[model samples]
Target: MEEMAIVFSPKYYEHNTGRDHPESSRRLKTVMRELKRLNLFSATTGCQLVEPELASIENLELVHDPEYVGLVKRICELGGGLLDLGDTVVSPKSFEVARYAVGGARKAVDSVLDGNYQKAFALVRPPGHHAGPYYGAGFCVFNNVAVAAAYLIEQHSFERVLILDVDAHHGNGTQEIFYDSEKALYMSLHEDPREFPGTGFVDEVGEGAGLGYNVNVPLPFGTGDEEYMKAFDEVVVPVARQYEPQFVLVSVGYDSHYGDPVGKLQLSAAAYESIFKKTLDLASTVCQGRLVAVLEGGYNLGQLGKLAALTISRMADFSYSMKDGTPPANSNVARRARRVIEKVEKAHSAFWKLRA
Candidate 1:
């Protein structure tokens, strides 16, 4: 077994939305091609490729409504149509492919927990962060990360799980699912929700026992790597250190890259490497290096492959960098980011030590 595992399946492509859809089969294909170009597929690469199983309906129900689960299947069976108002589309095999995506995430989690790999990345998609218990939106079918986290808490007896969503869009489904559960801590650094799915605000901290556990750092458009790293240093790193979770899961999305077609942020490919390095270090310190990352969104086919390969290289402890030098910081976004940090600190100080 390799030190890092990659869970994937070609079945993921069967969920075809359309040629023009940003979330197309070509995303995974590009990623796979780059991994090959980077020689990441060689037998000596120290990475293992694992196929994903189909997630059980029982497992799906852990984070989705049973009725909703049936509805997805029923809709697909009836020759598949739009899953929601528009963002999510379903083909005949989409239901099965989505289940496999969820299963891929679980496999990654299980691999880390079983000590077979220090970390794993699920390269499957139909990104789940936007899918909620009652509805699927933003190209998501089921809340894949949520299902994996709930599995850890309910089945494996793991108490503390930290979900770090670095997607361009807020993980609205993830936040809503764990909004009241202290067992899971949901943190997201997303494009301001005013853009889409519109929910991850500074004040939308968790409720009930989960109060202060949910953190959102909503950045304005044109925010670049520096601003994102600042948020990580001030908020993500500190909070992860304080939380000291038993396991860490990253909702990796490269859509924030400047080259992405759908997103408006200005992150460069290097931003992902920087973020992964920090997250990997955090996992080492707080969770014995047990970590798993799931693919969320990154529309630019050209950048996705390289960025995904770079992320896998980081997970495997290899050195690599993308030459797409990140653009200079947006000073205006920087000022606003500081304010957001202060607001988050005040909201969360009641629960965590904000300063060293």
Candidate 2:
């Protein structure tokens, strides 16, 4: 088996969101270029680049409403229009491309579960996580990660799956999709809703049978490596250990980086490395490294490729590094993050045993 599998396709670039939109083909272009420049596909790296098939309507209906699926297709068929009132642009080819993106995510999961690779990363586009059951928002046309998680439970008969979302923004759509399913535990660390916007508050835990299965850590603005690592050590790690999922999925988003123009948080490159390392270690311990990471968000064109390449290199166990200059040290942000962490721990105290 290879060390890692990367699911990608040149077709991902066919979904055009306009030249000035933050969610553009340029992001993947840069990432693929960087991956090549760093020789990540060399024989020494033990990484394979795999193309993905288009996700069938049956696969989409696993999580989304069938009517919504048809609606998207019809819209794209009529040329191009916005899926949501804001930002989410779609061209004539977008519906096909979006299906391909979901297919890429599912392919990653299959690659890992089939023992073809120890781990996999689906580097697809039109970033999901913000798209919900019937609506698409936040430059997202479909909820890729959610569909993959649902696919695991419905198609593979998996009982326990964990989705760790490290996007700077909360995965509201993902949380919504699995909000009442105990089989999928959704955890997210994002900038405070007050700073950004949308859901992911501390009290919005799961409901019904899925109660306490949803976890959110809304850090303060300017939150950096120290705060993120602390939350990972204290909250994310403990909850995940108790959940003991059969597989792990990460909604990996680099928008939290300080260099990202679209994201407001202050995370550095080292912080991202630590985040990936912790997730890998957790997966290794609980699920025998059955992990697949799907790209979500990150808008800084200049740094997007470098960060993505670094992540892939790390997955391949190859040495590649990029520094984010000096890490930010803000005592105020630290204090706020501590409060948020405390609140999250307290909120979920009844669900899992947390470290004091």
Candidate 3:
């Protein structure tokens, strides 16, 4: 069995959100170049590369409304346009590319579950996590990670699926999609929602049966590796250990890196490596190493490629380090993050025990 797999498709670059858009085709191009530079294609790495097929309508309906799906297809068929109130845009081929992205995520899930790979990373584009059941938002036309989670539940009969979203922005659409579902636990570590989609408040636990299943740790601006690691150790680690999911899916977004232009968080490539190591450890202990990471957001080309390469390297039990000289967190941000963590723990305490 392969230790790592990268789900990619040339069709992903055909989405064509726009030339000036932050989520552009050039993002994947830079990532591919970096992976090649790192010699990931060498025969010794044992990393399998899989090109995925386009997702079927049946699969898309698992997370998206049929009408919304039709609208996206029709819009793309008519030569494409803006998709939502946010940054989501589409060209003539975006619908196809978006479907392929979803398919790539699903393929990753299948590969991991079938023991073909211990872990897989879907490198396709038109980043998801922002697209909800009814609308596309934040450059996401379809919720790829959510679809993969739902697929695991319905197709594979998995009971608990954990989605760890490390995007700078909260995965509002993903939280919304699975808010009422106990089958999937959605946890997001993001910059404060007052800045972006405005949803991942500490108190906004899930609605019904999923009331405690959705966890949000909203950090302050200028939050760096120290603050983030603190939050993860205090909140994420405890909650994940209790949930004990059968599968783990990460909404991998490099925008949280300090070098990224879209997000203000002070994370470096080393921070990303640390995050991946923690996640892989959790998957190994609880889920039998059934983990898959799907691309969500990252605007900067240089950091995006480096962070991703470092993550995959770590997945293969190797180390590739890059330091971006991330700044230290101030006392104010640390205080704010501590307060947020407290609020999240108090709110989720009704559902999950805060400590291991």
Candidate 1 structure, TM-score to reference: 0.97
* lDDT, candidate 1, 45-148, per-residue tens: 67888888899999999999999999999999999888788769988889999999999999999988888888899999888999999999999999899999
Question: What's the ranking of the predictions by lDDT, best on top?
Answer: 2, 1, 3
Each model's C-alpha lDDT?
Answer: 0.89, 0.90, 0.89
Predicted structure 3, TM vs. truth: 0.97
Name the candidate that leads on lDDT. Answer: 2
lDDT of 2: 0.90
Clashing residue pairs in candidate 2 (N, C-alpha, C atoms within 3 angstroms): none
Give a tens-digit lDDT track for model 3, residues 1-356.
Answer: 24788999888989997778889989999999888887886777768789887899999999999999999999999999998766688999999899999999999998887888889999978888989999999999999999999999998898899999999999999999999989999999999889789899988889888879999998888898888988888888889989999999999999999888998788877778888889989999998888899999998987788888887888877657776776766888888888888888888887888742
Q: Give per-residue lDDT, candidate 1, residue 331.
A: 83
Worst 10-residue stretch by lDDT in candidate 2? 190-199
- Point out where model 3 deviates above 4 Å: none
Supply every candidate's count of residue pairs whose N, Cα or C atoms clash at under 3 angstroms: 0, 0, 0
